[model samples]
Target: MTTRTMLQRPAFHWLAAAWPYALIGLVTLLVRSPTFGNPILDFDEQLYLLVGDRMLHGHLPYVDLWDRKPVGLFALYAAIRLLGGSGIIQYQLIATACVVIAAWFVRAIVRRHMGEIPAIVAAVAYVLMLNVLHGLGGQTAIFYNALTAFAAWCACKANDANTPGRIAALALAAMLALGLAIQIKYTVIPEGIFFGCWFVWRLFAAGERLRRLLGIAIAMVLVALAPTGLALGAYALAGHLDAFLFANFTSIFLRQPFPTQVRNDQISQVVACCMALLTTAGVGLFQLRTHAHGRVYADFPLLAGWWVSAFAGFGMLGDFYDFYFLPVVLPSVILGAFALRGERRGFTFGCLLLLWPCIFIPANYFSRHQGILQTSRMVSAISPYVSGHCLYIYDGPTILYYLTNACIPTRFAFPDHLTNPIETRALGVDPVEEERRVLASQPGAIVTASRSVVPRVAPATQALVREALVRDYVLIARTPTIDRTYYIWARRDLHPGPAPLVDPRAANPQ
Candidate 1:
């Protein structure tokens, strides 16, 4: 075949189109592999995985595990655990894949509006921003943000096409993708709404009749609701509908607001992140205006709308955490990529702007290496103590529960439910009663963390669990070399007798 004909072949075209960005993505993955390979276990990661373990054993979430996280999050973990066993390697691999895919879409979306260099820069910016903004280490945001990015790209692709059937198919797929994303984290709901509205507007702008537009909107809404509907249906069939509803939806409003000082810290962190990206993007946007073209102007609304939606989603709960800033990273980078439009000087400047994150994230990751090692040692040391026995972590790291493979005596995983006043009120659980009941069984190991290490426990519930631990158990081991505080307690009666020593008043009373 002639060179032109060979180059025009579909497979060749696909490879020609894909390989460069794919190469960039692979390089991105390699740069990030150190952090991904050596997983730094987060409390959230532990609880989600623990819930997955329960699900693996045929236990449901709200009914058995008692966490407010959406069903889809645990389901992802459960699937990963089933396929790869309870190791961080599979989770990290999956997370890295999600990030790469998202970065690829960021490039595809930007390339449609700008040159290849700017597009590649946008993709790299996304990878850097996500890591530096604390979006790493197996967080749910990694997966959902990728889904949203793909959805955004599909929306752009669908908008540019003239065929109704093609548009309809893309719209349906996008909505379903977003529905799945929403189930992973309700925080993504605003972005979903933004996309839905944008999709409707695109159809309407295509000059469809009002009636047809209404019909299309209804169809899209139905598609978007499908994942959640199926989830609700399954819970209903299993007779866990109330539990599912309360945990997934109702309990969020009941969560107590953070203390004013803590809330201020969270706010400052969120604001700083937003300002860092936005200020940089704003400078780029000014340059973009100076070199304005119809194409760039046309794309402005889409990028801006995405930014607003992401910002809204991040702050949806009127509270902030480090990971919450993740969704905004892509839009910020894409907007900043516009500044690379002019000449070599502009391109060089944009490269420098994006390079700043490369410096700090590696340093930060290395600094935390010590903490990761300490955590590993602690988990290893404590694992043997709870083998084949029930364990209770009284205001301690939830990761220990997962590491030990022990039976949990209570639904509350992190003691936040029993100790955080807001959490207790939100769940409407009696903390003292819950503690008394958990202690009644006299678990083989009751691990109590030092007060300094155990953050955010309510005073009353802390006292209640502590008192029960003191009365019922004897200290067996204390982690000496680990940097953090950890104490292991064995039931006092179990050492001397086969049957658990029962005190009728203590066991039966309120």
Candidate 2:
């Protein structure tokens, strides 16, 4: 039979043909087994985990913890913690399941638009993409991104005439999922904006005028805002309204320009942006030429548009990290896979042949950088040290949540006078007064990025820390990895001491 004849086979027959691909994708996902790896405790992960841990202990994210993230994320983490016992294994399992389910959604969406083979290819590509794999680690952002993709898939499925009810259900689901995504990281805002636009387009295509669209939009807004509004109400009731509004919301939005070290090279930035745009455009052109009228192909533009929106939004923020693009890039992988499938057999094979080396060559080089592997190891090793002591970590939240059963604070506080002057001033507090308060409190320990500890503090505050170390405090240990330096300091007498004289040289230690 001709390829076209085979492609036109009955749905059940097509399912039978595609079963092998599904099985392969499933096995690949299972073997990758999200839980086998240790949890990496980075700043965001640590904070999220801490919030989850606190929730488990009756503290809320924006309430007891001073975080700006919406409450949906914490609630989800709380649910996971309840189910999985708050271990790395449980969290990994949850993350893995989320990815697998997302893959299934991708398959369903693809099957609806493209034929079985293209659907299978899309699913497999999604499962194997570097960003997808990168997200499998125990971070709240991964779950949030997966949720975003799942919501988009639901919307795609619902847009079909045969599935209006399904679409409504999916819209509701998307609304709720977005609530949770926002809670995990506010960055999902741009993603929501992108999806919201698509949702409106879908409504418009359904022959609904502005009035109907407005009604549906209002309903969606209400459903999405319910969880967030409820969380805010709870925060107000707890008498933390100011803290929630100021610290979590306003403070973050008003953050200063990117520091010198945090900024990327302009040339590299332009190059990365070009590569992303070209790849997206290439996929779009391929789709239009090969399957112009295909529903599956049609969805590509919407998905790609959302991705482009997210990338542009994130890029302009100046804190662009490769992983920030994971949510948007994930759908593109499937589109790219389908694009490849539509190519001539020989060309497709040639592209496949070059793919591995293209990825691995650079990855291998990055692995050799100083402290890279060591930093990874330190992050992975955080699970064992979560007992008894209140774990203070600057960069390792994912690790902290998996390992400890203690209440983790939201923001990592520095010594009072040493706090970022700009941040302190922005919050309308005198840095010196805040410093005195923090010193008086005499926290058990302070954990921070080694470099930030210097630049963020005034010379006098730096001197205070050095003097305290020399007299009233002891250096418990110093954990230096390629990407991080963790200094654990303890009181020399395990109690407060006389306020020591500040040495100016302490701040700019040569």
Cα lDDT, all candidates:
0.73, 0.54
- Against the true structure, candidate 2 reaches a TM-score of 0.73
Candidate 1 ranges with C-alpha deviation above 4 Å: 1-16, 37-40, 273-275, 285-293, 343-353, 358-364, 367-376, 450-455, 474-484, 492-510
Relative to the unseen true structure, what is the C-alpha lDDT of residue 143 in candidate 2, on a scale of 0 to 100? 75
- Model 2 bad stretches (over 4 Å): 1-37, 84-86, 112-121, 124-136, 162-170, 209-213, 266-281, 284-286, 294-300, 316-318, 342-436, 445-464, 480-485, 494-510
lDDT of 1 at 395: 53
Q: Write the per-residue lDDT of candidate 2 for residues 296-329, one digit (tens) a residue.
A: 5457677667657666655644555545655654
Q: How many steric overlaps are in each model, in order?
A: 1, 12
Please, what is the TM-score per model?
0.87, 0.73
**Alpha carbon lDDT at 376, candidate 1:** 71
Which candidate number has the best TM-score?
1
Q: How many steric clashes does model 1 contain?
A: 1
